[model samples]
Target chain A: MTVKVEKIEGGIPHNTIMVAGLIASVVLVYLTYANVLTGTQYFAFFGGLATVAALVWGSHTIKHLCSYGIGTGVPSAGMMAFGSGVIAMLFATKYGIAAPIVAVILAAVVGAILGYVANNVLNMKIPVMIVSLVEMAVIGALVLMGYAAMMSGSFELSALTTGSVSILGLSLPSYQASFLGGALIATAFMLGGIAIQHPFNACLGPSWTQDRMLYLAAECGFLSMIAAAIMSMPLISMGAALVSLFVAVIGWYYTYAKYIELSKRDAFSWLDSKPIPEVEGQ
Target chain B: MESIVFGIGITALAGALATVAGAAENTESDIGSQGDPNSQVQLAPQMGYLHRIFNKAIAGEPPAWGLWIALGAGIAWAFMAMQVNPILAIVLGAALATFVQGVYATTAYLGRTASLAKFGQPVFVDVLKSMTTVTMAHAFVAIFATVTVCHLMNAALGHPFPLPLLGLVWGIALGAAGSATGNPFYGKERQYQNQKYGAGVPIAASGNIVRYAEAGERNSLDNGWFSARLGGPASGVCFGLIVFLELWRTVLFEHIAAGWGAIIIGIIIILVFMVIDRYIEVWARKNYGPYGKPAEEASS
Candidate 1:
């Protein structure tokens, strides 16, 4: 079965997610100011924000902002800042002002650095498993060192989880398993993205046509690879290779096909002489 | 003038914004993969005839001027700013900044790409997208980190600077400087793709410095005159140094307000350099047509 992560079936719009989170933060602040929020609730709020910021900054969606104008809004980057503030709240009871400030600062540093590299160093197009393996390695190291702060409580991204399986006394790093699986999913998407887009554009000249394919493949690869790596690491306790193989083919196919189909569709709409509105990632 | 302060503030704000944005935003592009070198969005064209010309003109390898300057100025600047063992601050701050920002870029890059791919989104494909920004951001990061480290050091030495405001000042100062220097060299040409810088930066004897901008009027009929050829790195020295010195003095402000004034002056210096970095330096390099051997002995 073809798995499509794009155009999630009746899933919340990216913007809606932002707005919802913003509201949550506002309410959180209001509640905190009102002295109504319990300590646990506040920490949870902060944790959620950090996870989202880290995810967004760490995601391939950043590429969308540069190309298709998907997640480039103020709220997108602001999500991390808000998340940082929220995460800081987690340590507020213990550290006071320093807690939130330090948490947000660290979160921002982590999120932004990863985001910058995703856009800059990697050129945002490493292969799915490649990104997954690298992230898993780091996440694993983190887990080993007993510093799995972010993953221990990321209920927001828990949707990637299927069911927890125990191996050695405790859970088999459910977050790591999810992360590896997600990376595979991202890879499958781009493969699909390129597969669907390449065939129909046979009309262009040789060099022009080849360049177009490269561009498409790059986009699909970058997005999926990044997404899977960030979202799937914690889920990767299923074994890196297993999780990678599980999601790789499907993620690549859907993502590649989605773009290929979009390209063909966009190409055809122009043929019928209809102007198409600029879609999410132009 | 009030306009100057406002402009300084606004400029500082812009650098700060980009710094924070760069700090927060994730950018990772793969090369030789499905990634597009273009996706890295830079103002300078990666390849050009002008770049070839400069490469040919350079004839020899570029001297380590820019690098040395960055290293040396960094130390000197630190010493002047804070007399607590200047070289120590430079080495420590620059090293720390490089390592920190480097890891930050690597992890952020990985995380961002993974997320985008999660939804089957297309990741950007550019090579130089974050190169200049990261370098310049380091200017800010290093400055801020230095200040913080210095602040702690000061406390240990029975003196302390306001932690928050010191970060703000150091960040703004270095950011403005970086935007002025690195951006023009790396960022400007992708836009104009015709600029250059000389003297301070030694390129290949073949002028292999492939940049978008060129310095001064390399091809003017008046190339015979002293003004045009002498204008770039050489002229830049006299023109900007006075102001640079004044600002340096300000960073060592005996009073807090002086520090603010110093930051403002430093911003001006940075802005001036940025203008040159973008317009003049880049234009010169591009116009000069690569850093290489002159037009006479053409292999063509």
Candidate 2:
């Protein structure tokens, strides 16, 4: 008698697993604001980690959709996602944490409409086009808002408008707003964009697997959070930045090791073998 | 003052929404300051006539060392002009922007060629062509976006941004976006014919290079023609929206109120592109097909 072999499935669907983690992270960060976590360092460090986690999920989706070979190119998908995200975050911060629901509704509506148009009208022809577009936009918003809150040290309307003056029908810039708008927002914006999109773009082909991509995603996300911490140096407490830097290094090393392990399993070890002839110096 | 439910909901839903998008996939340059023939880069001949034309127009070889020199001068001139007059500043700035982009295009071509060659795949002119197309769009977006951001921020803050600082922001952002978007197209266009150990199995293999929305035959005039027609307007619209929104935000006391308007307008602008992109898709599919237009038809 012959026995049939069955292909094993991931214990939880990849998307489900990532989203659950993302939600948990956001809620945990909010606890810091609620006096539940206590300490500026607590908010900054955890908030940075949460922001990176969102991008990790974003990167996974990028890999999923781009694998289909969207004609417009992979980075376009990332750009489009960030574009919507930037808008949502700006609007959300304008309202402060008081009206969080507005930004959520705003991001979803924009993403859904864009996705619908991409799939139905543009005929982007990817099987996952609509869902991918919406998710990308929404996550983009989360990454932006989360990082903004951490850097500003709170989720207040003043985070956006605090640094400007009104003069002769023109608004003047304030150092705080400039730092947030220009440096902090710009770094998080671009870093989150790349963290989510770069993995799949770098690792496309037959060797590409969900497991491997997620591992790489985790690595990129941690690195970007480290970037956020560095950019936040002028604004956040030094303790917060130091803690974030430490956590990022540990997070990156762990994820990178997992990625290497996966890569070793699939890649040719011969490629890493020592050369038959040593270099002249050696 | 705190509602954990709503606050958490905002992030949670956004994350969940990203999940739907996320669950969807389930996962997955340096140019400058050097010389000598040995150090200078060159392109393969098969890159063809368009390569020659580009080289000639830029007044140097394919890597445009001469133009790189001109770009240095242009930047210096632009900075000087900034001290003289706004009109002169604008003119010199435009000149500087052109040379800056020319350097970028040349560098991108050389950079992309080296990258592909490292993997053992020969690049076609279409690789350069596709990159230049995206570069033009992104260059336009980056310049305008930078100017708008700086101008508005300065106006709002009652202090002007240092010109050098503005230039840095503008140049860095443009360069970043270009490399981010352009390199992937090169990776996508070619794959190993026989590789079990590698990642590059074609998603749908026809052995033909796949371009996203390029019009007409590969390397044909019509292809260049349509790409300009589509990409140019789309980029222009993006630039316009950014400029308008920045202006509106700067002038209004209610900046966030204006932000809402900006968001709506932004969505509309994107929707318009969607309509145009859709129209282009239909046109290309009906007229071109996978192999593109017949050579005879292409010539006409």
Candidate 2: tens digits of C-alpha lDDT, residues A159-269: 433444334657655553333444445545555665566555444433345676667667767766655554444445557767777887798778767865665454322
lDDT of 1: 0.29
Candidate No. with top TM-score: 2
Q: What is the Cα-based TM-score of model 1?
A: 0.30
- Candidate 1 lDDT over residue span A135-236, tens digit each: 222211111111112212222223233324455546443432331221222222221222222221111111122222333433333332323222223332
Q: Which candidate gets the maximum lDDT versus the true structure?
A: 2
Shift of residue A280 alpha carbon in model 1, Å: 30
Candidate 1 lDDT, B1-300, residue by residue in tens: 564454444334333333332221111111111111212221111211121000000000011111211322232232332333644655554453343233223222222232223223222222113332433343344334334333432333222332222333333343233333323322222212332543333233222233222453121111112122222222233323432354233434324574576676667767986888689767876886555766597576
In candidate 2, how many clashes are counted?
16
After superposing candidate 1, which stretches have Cα over 4 Å from the reference?
Answer: A1-12, A23-282, B1-100, B108-145, B148-161, B186-300
User: Compared with the true structure, what per-residue lDDT tens digits does model 2 show for residues B208-271?
Assistant: 2222223322321222243234332333333333334433433342245655754665666668
**Model 1: lDDT of residue B42:** 16
For residue A184, give model 2's deviation from the true position in Å.
2.4
Instruction: Report how far residue B71 has shifted in candidate 2, in Å.
Output: 24
